[model samples]
Target: MSGYGVVIPAFNAATTIAETLRSVVAQSVKPDAVIVVDDGSTDDMAAVINALNLKVRLLRQENTGPGSATTRGIAALSTPFIATLDADDLWLPTKIEEQLAHFRRFPQVAGVFTHWRNFHHDRPDAPEAVTVPGWSRSTMMIRREVFDAVGPIVDPPGGRGEMIDWIARAREAGLVLDMLNEALTLRRIRPGSLSYGRDAARDRGYLEVARLAMQRRARNRTEPS
Candidate 1:
């Protein structure tokens, strides 16, 4: 209910991770811990982290995808709440403060997500207007119970859709999830990022996630009350 930490899943994010961590450090509510799990990054992530002079734990592993990296970061934290941030995103100074306030207001919700806007990495000065409540992992502040009840971010084959599966699974498990209307995150839209370009593999992951969700729904429908 009180303590929270930050987990960042990185894959060759050395160029952008320092700024991401800076955003965390700028939060009004300081995190209990911060961990970055590098998923087989061939970059000098260690050097970048060291030079930043910020308190961050760096963990390295083979290329397992962002979901696995995120779960690893989550497991390494010893806090009641876990907030995730992508290596290429930035959180406004009040991001954590606003989320913690939402928790106090809801009292019973398992997770809180805020709206976000995307900005081109090269044109950081030209951020788009905040449009909608984005139920993204980068915008989420969740209780550890959500994972304990549901599970870690699904590692479907390929690029994206794992978070979609994660959110769906959380809902199926009857967890109380809510999102704030306030935009608190700035997503960097850059080339070479996982979500930057769509491909067949990404689509395949989507199909797999959808199938799994449908199967879960069917199972729930058949289960006796």
Candidate 2:
């Protein structure tokens, strides 16, 4: 075991998951294990993954949100360190290697992330590569201990801001985090993706995330330290 593993939470991601898995397998520092939680995917997601004959462990469950799926995936991984990736995202060949390097350099930090660029799923070839802004679920690599400390990701009612809630909680717990300036992940911009369209559900999710975050802040302020 390399003491490193990956957890991917997928939902009807058959269209792009193979390429995403390829990106992980092609990493310079290959993960020791990869676990994928199929969050009640209606598509042929499982078949697609199986056809690839890749080194992945697939678990199926009811239609839970990404946060629940992510929690399940993390629990199934035994590695001391874990990295997460979305089923539709791609990482550079050296993404894991670079993150591991950052960990070794900043031993005090709880996690390491890298910058990323957005690429249209249809035009995968034309992406400019390496853009501003990082620190997404697909870019975070952290110790298993931090995850246990933080607990499972809180899946909101609308199901879009769970990661946002989890990160805020991690920060509230005082765990130090770091992000590399170099871009190593490519976020796929797809029209049918959950985060693509602005709808009532997404808006409700955003509001709930904000409300929960604020609520946490209030509780923290009141806690007897």
Candidate 3:
């Protein structure tokens, strides 16, 4: 099997890191290696990773935010493909197997993203599926070279906007982006989630990404002839 690596950037995630690790460890198509980047958590998150005894490469750095931690993790990977999972999220057993098959089927595809189910942390109800447009980072798997070409994931001023900016850049670079249309991951919604209480900020973040995408499109349009 061709190898793929997983990067899990964590911060103050002691409450959920174990489950995330277990899900990765249980993947039907196991990762070539798993790396957990502990982004300066002032908690027992490191102890949690140690107690799990998972076969994951661990890297610790001062709190530089998720984009920086993700960049560090990707730089440390020796595989051709890379996948990311937030500490509060999990992958289904077939997530890797399914996405890997998709990549193989579409060799031209530089990155693939899947639909996700969102659930309240303590709720048993089925998760709500969020229909995202075009390329999104909430559910993505990408070739390592894509990052190498487009550069590191940028820290978009604030919030989860950096994800959108990265995707926009990939699209601008003529990278083929596709949706697997399957619920490969579960993104948990909790009390203090940045997405939960910061409505105005989140909306602003979305607009910033939209503006960036529009600017890229306009540039592409006027470049030739």
Candidate 4:
């Protein structure tokens, strides 16, 4: 088995899935296994994946939201190291190689994230850096044991803003999150993306994450440190 595994949570990502898969397959240090979780996509995403035949695994499940799909994929991983790449995102050929090196150099870090360029499908020339506090899923490579230690991602009620909740839980578990400071991924920003249209929901998610992180910090201070 490959020492590393990648889990991709996809939903109707026909437009970009092929490119994403190719990017991973073409990596200098390919993952031992790559899993694509088809989260109840109504489109031809299945067909697209089947056509690749790149030795990657595909898991199909009913629409359970990205957080749950990701959780399931993490459970299915058999490697010591696991990374996440959304189906709509593209990774550099050296993404995995760089992350593995970082993990080796810093064994105590539970996860590593890289800088990424953001591009809109319609506007490819105007690629910009994605700068958000905390972490972005597209850039993170995590140790499988981190999940076992912290617990699986908890799906929030109403199936909204679950990613925020997952990240909060990780920080609470004292996982050392490190940034590689290299652009290893490209995130596609669609017109009506959650970062754009769902401003209110995104803000609420950010607030929740900040509050939990602060509370955890306060509690840590009160402890015998």
Candidate 5:
């Protein structure tokens, strides 16, 4: 992976987008290209991106769920490796640099994920930091071939299960996924954020993904290998 690209899926994130972009811009290892997918924001997200005049590309599409928006951004990029970032989240200066280094060390690993810290948008003074155990889209840098092997991201009905489902499927396919165990991404907790609160529809999507994963496992066990 000589070069990497970032895809940020945003919707009505006019307020926090600049901070997110700033984080990407300050990375120790700069991205080859940055693509921001404007998921039909009613807010001034487009205006804000344009106003910044940063070396980023903005693509607009009808209001699709974040999963679809992110997938669209991925499809538009030709980089060997890609990372996804939410418009509200921030990556530490060495986030990409460390991940690329890890990839160099373990070239067989198809994906690299790191621990992440969470902070509320309102609480910057003493932001509660934690090492998130599982993988999240925002914390991952994956080879493009992994997507070709795993298939497109699963767009759950209401949203919020794409990353989970993709990781599950990739694991089932025997992909080598390695973790750095360092908190590199800062996830922002804010009102109305999809990860902020529990929703029945979103929860159902997660359960459905779990169900499918289990089914696949069971079927694989029964098959004549």
Candidate 6:
């Protein structure tokens, strides 16, 4: 039997953490271990975790960005495969089971990810769901060895470009991530999420991520085969 560990990097997510935890707990394929890294949230994140009575390992630290928190959480786990979920997002019950099955079928792949569905809380009369096609951070289940080869995610200063930077780096490293062709995660569109808002700093952060990734690709190309 094979299983994966889950790492959730949360910051000031008291309102949604409970639901998020429940979603993971309800997974058809339970995680072998669940680690949540609280990045200096003023809210009662600890209390929420405690109240759940789940076997979750909690870690605390100063207000580091999500990238750093995720790194810490991954370092704390020893599972062969690792997955991530945003504090406000929900994973469908079959997410891990299906991804793991894909891995077994194509052991050469570095990871598996799925498209995501955006659930908007603002418009009650809006369509029930809107499908977004692309790789999402929360939907990923990565092989541990791939991280060693490509390196941990490069979290931009504002934490906006970490996933983009990571995917770019992985592609440059020849890591192949399979698309599951399904929406396995529900991304909540609500206030206070890091995903919310766009600003000059955020734009610059994306450019910086692209620049760094291009440098890595060029460097990898020059290295001896």
Report each candidate's C-alpha RMSD, comma-separated, in the order given. Answer: 1.2, 1.5, 2.4, 3.1, 1.5, 2.1
Question: In candidate 6, which residue pairs get closer than 3 Å at backbone N, Cα or C atoms, i.e. clash?
Answer: none
Ordered by TM-score, highest first, the candidates read 1, 2, 5, 6, 3, 4
Please report how far candidate 4 places residue 153 from its true position, in Å: 2.0
Stronger candidate by lDDT (1 vs 6) = 1
Residue 95 alpha-carbon offset, candidate 5, angstroms = 0.5
Per-residue alpha-carbon lDDT of candidate 6 for residues 1-225, written as tens digits (9 for 90 to 100): 478899999999888899889999999999999999999999998998999999999999898688788888999989999999889888888988899889999989998998788776454323346666557679989998887787776568666888888887788767898888778888888876778777777667788897887787788789899
For candidate 3, lDDT tens digit of each residue in 62-106?
Answer: 987788888899999989989998888878889888888999898
Find the 10 residues in a row with the least total lDDT in model 5.
Answer: 125-134
The TM-scores, one per candidate, come to 0.96, 0.95, 0.89, 0.85, 0.94, 0.92
Q: What do the candidate models score in CA lDDT, each in turn? A: 0.88, 0.88, 0.81, 0.79, 0.88, 0.84
TM-score top scorer? 1
The window of 10 residues in a row where model 1 has the poorest summed lDDT is 123-132
Task: Please identify model 2 stretches exceeding 4 Å from their true place.
Answer: 125-130
Candidate 4, residues 13-126, lDDT tens digits: the string is 888899889998899987788999998999999898899888878899998777778889988988998888888888888988998888888888888888887777776624
Model 4, runs deviating above 4 Å: 125-134, 157-160, 199-225
Q: Supply candidate 4's per-residue lDDT for 36.
A: 91
Native-referenced Cα lDDT, model 5: 0.88
Which pairs clash in model 4?
A: 2-32
lDDT of 2 by residue, 1-225 (tens): 246999999999999999999999999887899999999999999999999999899999999788899999999988989999999999999988887887887888898888898888778544566587676789999999999999998788777888888888889889998889888898888997877768786668778989988898899899899
Clashes of 3: 0
User: Pairs clashing in candidate 1?
Assistant: none
Better of 3 and 5 by TM-score: 5
lDDT of 5 by residue, 1-225 (tens): 489999999999999999999999999989999999999999998888888889999999998788888889999999999999999999989999999999899889999998888888987823455577548888889999998898878777667788899998898899999988878888898989888899897677788787888899899999998
When 4 and 5 are scored with TM-score, the better candidate is 5
Give candidate 5 regions above 4 Å deviation: 125-128
